[model samples]
Target: MRCSCCQKELINSLTLQELFFSSSQRCYHCEQLFSKIDQAQVCPGCGRPNSTELCQDCCLWQQELGFVMRNFSLFSYNEGFRQWIETYKFMGDYRTRGAFVLELTEALQKYQEYLICPLPLSKERFEQRGFNQVRGCLDLTKRSYELLLKRSELAPQSEKSREERLQMKQPFELNVPIEKIRNQKVLLVDDVYTTGRTLFHGAELLYKSGAETVKSLTFAR
Candidate 1:
């Protein structure tokens, strides 16, 4: 195998334990670079790796939005992870999906009972990208829905400041009826959680539609 980010050859003798249990497709160095969020040290709300009792973003979210969301992220949005995202999601290197399948699948298993939903892309973005980045990361057993639709093209969230992201108009619309999702627990899946703007927007719509609980899971934060 080779490192997903560096494209360097990986050499190792597989142990019995690794053959049986390990699902890593990347080399040791590349794998180590993609830092996993330590569950014990994460913020209660956003799941970011933090030493603080409550991360400033989460605290601000609670104060201004009057609610807090529980989000679980697998990896930090570091340079390595960002490049991997660029390749898989933007460059359309579909084979890169294999690198994350096992990890993403395991993370999503706990949310199986909830209504799993992938964050939608605008029609233009979908045409440009040729696939939904969130959906590509998921395994087939994990069912998802097109519950939300991107109403129109907007500025790339990456280009915006935190305040701009938080204040951006709601971009998602419900394709499913409130009656269908009423009292349902929703798990919104996405490729990345930057300022939590997109996920919160989806959550707000779900809440307005009477969802019992709204949470999010992302590949990176």
Candidate 2:
């Protein structure tokens, strides 16, 4: 096998349990390039590492929105993560989606009862990128998901300043029937969580549409 990130030949060094149960696709060296977040030490609201309680950003969200978000993130948005995203998302290297399949699959087990919903890309963005980055990762997990939201064309989040992101208007509209969301739990999936604006907007819409609960998961924070 070859490492998904570096394309180097992989060495078979897994223990029996790992060999049987693990679905990791990257070599040790490539994997080590990214930093993992310790769930226990993270902020209760947004999963910011080393935080004991809600981070300031999350507290602000609660003050403004009347609810706090429960987000789980696996990796820190460090240099390695930025590089990976640059290649996988901006460079349109679709195959890099496999690099985190094992991590995503394991993390999602806890939300098995919740409907998985990957954030939608605007039509223009999807055409330019050729795929929805969040959905690309979710697809490799072989899990079912719903395209329950449609996005309007807008500036990409990556290009927006923190103030701009926070001020941005809601860009998502429900793409499915209200009955589909009513009384259901939803797990919103995204490639990254920046200022909490985008996810909060989606959550607000779901809550107003009668969703029982809404949580979010992102590969990076």
Most accurate candidate by lDDT = 2
> Which residues of candidate 2, in runs, are more than 4 Å off?
12-23, 153-168
Predict model 1's lDDT versus the native. Answer: 0.78
Which regions in candidate 1 have their CA more than 4 angstroms from the true location? 1-12, 140-168
Candidate 1 local lDDT, 5-74, one digit each (tens) = 4556766686778756876667776676577878788887888887537789988988977778899999
Give candidate 1's error at residue 41 in angstroms: 0.6
Instruction: Write down the TM-score of every candidate.
Output: 0.83, 0.88
Can you list the residue pairs that collide in candidate 2? none
* lDDT tens digits, residue span 1-221, model 2: 77876777877776788766655667887687578898889999998999978889988999999998899998999998999999899998887887887788999999989999999988988899989999988988898999878885577889999997875688888999999999999999998988888999999999989999999999999
lDDT of 2: 0.88
Model 1, residue 198: C-alpha shift (Å): 0.9
- How many steric clashes does model 1 contain? 0
